[model samples]
Target: MTCREASEYLQELMDTTLAPDLERRLRAHLDTCSACAGELTLQREIRRRVAAGVPRQEVPSALRQKVREILAPREKWAWGFLPRPVIRWGMAVAALVLISLIPLTLLQQNREERIASIVIEAVNDHRSFAMRVNLPTLPTADREQVRELVEAKVGFQIVPPMGQRGELRLVGGDVTYFLDRKVACILYGKGSKLVTLLVLRDEGIEATEQGFRQVNGLRVYTATYKGTGVVLWKQDNLLYSLVSELPQEELLGVAKEMAKI
Candidate 1:
């Protein structure tokens, strides 16, 4: 699909309303086109922010009255002056959709926002390493010692997978706050590319198997949030979200290996 075609399907892709075949084609386009992928990521973030930050309230009577007045026999219909009963029926359906849709749309958006947020934040935090790479960090040559040092600072022991990541060398790590909860970010690198592993206490909302999949027989949640790949899994009281810009197969390969331990 060309960029133009992909753009048309993007909203449906976000809404999951596209046919499976079309969705696959658009996804293929996104995988190879960084510009479109970035566009999608931008749109998704905006949608999520609106869903999560907006306040919800019941429809006010004044607003209802205003709507009623507006819908009350506006002007000539394109089908040449519709009958009163026909107009009233149209108004009733429109009003039903408008008045009842608010809460339902809000509920759906709230759930989508919550689940989408499970990994988008990790994607963002990983992206931030570009700017923060120059910041001082504990040496990551020794994973065990690095983990301990991070625990000392963050007051939480993070168990990063002791599995082969091919050429990904541990760059460095730091402690930070996400949603007011203390967390650890361990950076790994191969050449100039990077991957981030975030460890934080489970806040309970992420338990749902929203983007769930099995990696090496272990259940892991995966998503393509913010134009990057993320894999999430929980062990004990802690949750692990691995974020990278790699293809899903490569990303999941590392994650499955990490899940082995």
Candidate 2:
């Protein structure tokens, strides 16, 4: 190998990709040329330092706040509402993945996008409702009256599955919407565990063989968003979802029990 050839092969040598004959020739040239050997050593050192995974310098808190203020309009639509930094990244990615992935053709044929949309919304509501029960002042209801309140206010009759599990109790239920679809937000809890069940008109929300599992002969769509478990299934003309921090299998059981209603 000439000096020029050795220079050209330096990257491949560092990458361990040179052929036997060419690599032997390059090594022979490098052994005789002090300048080429030094260059190869320098390249190896550079590669080693880059592959070391150096820590990044975080921006100062004050500078970050200033940048956020300057970018508030865009950031508000992005991450401003998500209170904790820990949940922010996961939520943003999940939310973005569903939106950016669905093409027009897939939107017509599949329910994956719809599942993700509901899961994200359900988890958001689950977190908020868990913090503070969003009890409506006008049409309030206790455990016994939650079903009646949901029927009257939400324009749908739902058997709130408070009786499905021993550790579950009815907390609240309210009328909400996603796009133009009226949604029934049924909140339940037992001890410290929280569960939010959303009932909406079915919009082709079916469980595909790949992303869903059959539970008690029902196609159940179970997903984990952030650390929360989301179980979505359709019964009759309405779609149902149970969102909580409970184990997904438990959620599936609860969903299956709710489907029986």
Candidate 3:
């Protein structure tokens, strides 16, 4: 391969995603191409620095306490002696209040923990899908369909990365169950770069004004998937997130697209 080709392939090589033959060719080109070698060295250094600088912080005790309070039942009354109508009305009101508070409580507890769980699941999904990258039997469209299938099967949606329609294309997606939650991951590729979007079940998120937050050193901006932004609220027992690595503007656009879906 030419020097430019090899240089472009270096990103995949760093991620260990390139085919063996192509990787060898790229390495040979790098051996003789000073510019490419220098570029790879710089990329490696940046990756190393990023890895060394970002340490995972533990969830704060205050947050944990708050979460417990939110998730913990406020009052438990024995209803065995109550009349049917009285018990039904009381139970319904209690359920409504509990449903309303759970998401708020979870948010108060630790948003970072929620985000970390999702990110880890996404990374695992990416690793699994990478195995099919070079499989001749897997068509590109089929890869994308596979991801969508997993999302459907797992009862979640996958947000395609930005610029996918015109520039980057859907590569694949995977479903992973982690922390007793289901996460759907959709992978997109632009040239040689790949980005994955992870969506966790929305049973635990609270309904509140949309906002932005960062976790695990990654910037996480939240908004509703279709309308204004995601309502940090809970429904049933799931927490929902429409997440992506696409820039904020593009992610917002994609969220709008998701609303249509």
Output the number of the lDDT-best candidate: 1
Instruction: State the number of backbone clashes in model 3.
Output: 22
lDDT of 1: 0.77
TM-score of each: 0.52, 0.55, 0.36
TM-score of 2: 0.55
Global CA lDDT computed for model 2: 0.76
| Candidate numbers sorted by TM-score from highest down | 2, 1, 3
**Which ranges in model 2 have alpha carbons more than 4 Å from their true place?**
1-110, 133-144, 203-210
Tens digit per residue, CA lDDT, model 3, 1-261: 787687779889999999999988998888888988999999999999999999999999999988877886543345557778987898899999999997787667675556554545544454445455533222344555665566676775443434435664666655557655666555666455444445566544432223444333333345432222221222234343444434556555544433322
Q: List model 1 lDDT by residue over 1-261, tens digit each.
A: 999999988899999999999998999999999999999999999999999999999899999988887897554347547788987898899999898897776456654465566577788788878557445267466678668768888777775554474666777777767754777888887567678888888765553566566667767888886678888877777778888888888877777777645
Tens digit of lDDT per residue, candidate 2, span 143-235? 557677667776767767654556667667776777347788887775679878889877545433347777788877888898999987777
How should the candidates be ordered by lDDT, best one leading? 1, 2, 3
Runs in model 3 deviating more than 4 A are 1-108, 119-139, 156-165, 207-210, 213-261
**Which candidate comes out best when scored by TM-score?**
2
Number of the candidate with higher lDDT, 2 or 3: 2
Better of 1 and 3 by TM-score: 1
lDDT of 3 at 239: 42
